[model samples]
Target: MTYTRVCPLAEIPQDGALAVEIDDTPVALVRSGEGVFALSDICSHAEVSLSEGEVYDGTIECWLHGSCFDLASGKPTNPPATQPVATYKVKVEDGDVYVSLGSDE
Candidate 1:
């Protein structure tokens, strides 16, 4: 899979998220204590931007309905989201963040 550079690693705040678009795919770049993760920016339950929400403990909370999704697997850890969002592969190289849209990891 081809990985496209999204943004600088410094752009994403620690324990927070940032929204980016690669080839028209909206991706939420999340930084947790473990590492950086990439997921679909839209929340599965509300079709809202997940990057606008809060990130804690490797989970991103949906701002609209309080749904929390796990960054690693894109699984919803809390309601009102039942379905999981899409997750992409993420890599950091030379202080830059890259995301692969070819597969839903």
Candidate 2:
């Protein structure tokens, strides 16, 4: 997989999410606790931007329908979203964040 440098790890707020695009794919860079995760920015149920939602306990909630998704697996933890979104591989090096969209991790 080809890893692309998205931004510095500091850019993503703690316990929050950041919206970014890689190769025309909208992705959400989520920072929860002390870890970083990457997933599709769009919500499966409402087709809204997941990055604008709430992040807590390793899950991101869809702002429109209140569907919470696991940051690592992109699986919807609650109803309104039965399908799982896509998740990508992420790595941190020298305080910078890198993401790979070649395949869902």
* lDDT score, candidate 1: 0.94
Best of the candidates, lDDT: 2
**Every model's Cα RMSD, please?**
1.5, 1.4
Q: For candidate 1, give the lDDT of residue 43.
A: 97
Q: Model 2: per-residue lDDT, tens digit, 1-105? A: 789999999999999999999999999999999899999999999899999999998999999989999998999999989999999999999999999998644
Candidate 2 accuracy as TM-score: 0.96
TM-score of each: 0.96, 0.96
Clash count for candidate 2 is 0
Error at 88, model 1, angstroms: 0.3
- Cα lDDT tens digits, model 1, 5-97, are 899999999989999999998999999996999999999999999999999988999999999999999999988899999999999999999
Off by over 4 Å in 1: none
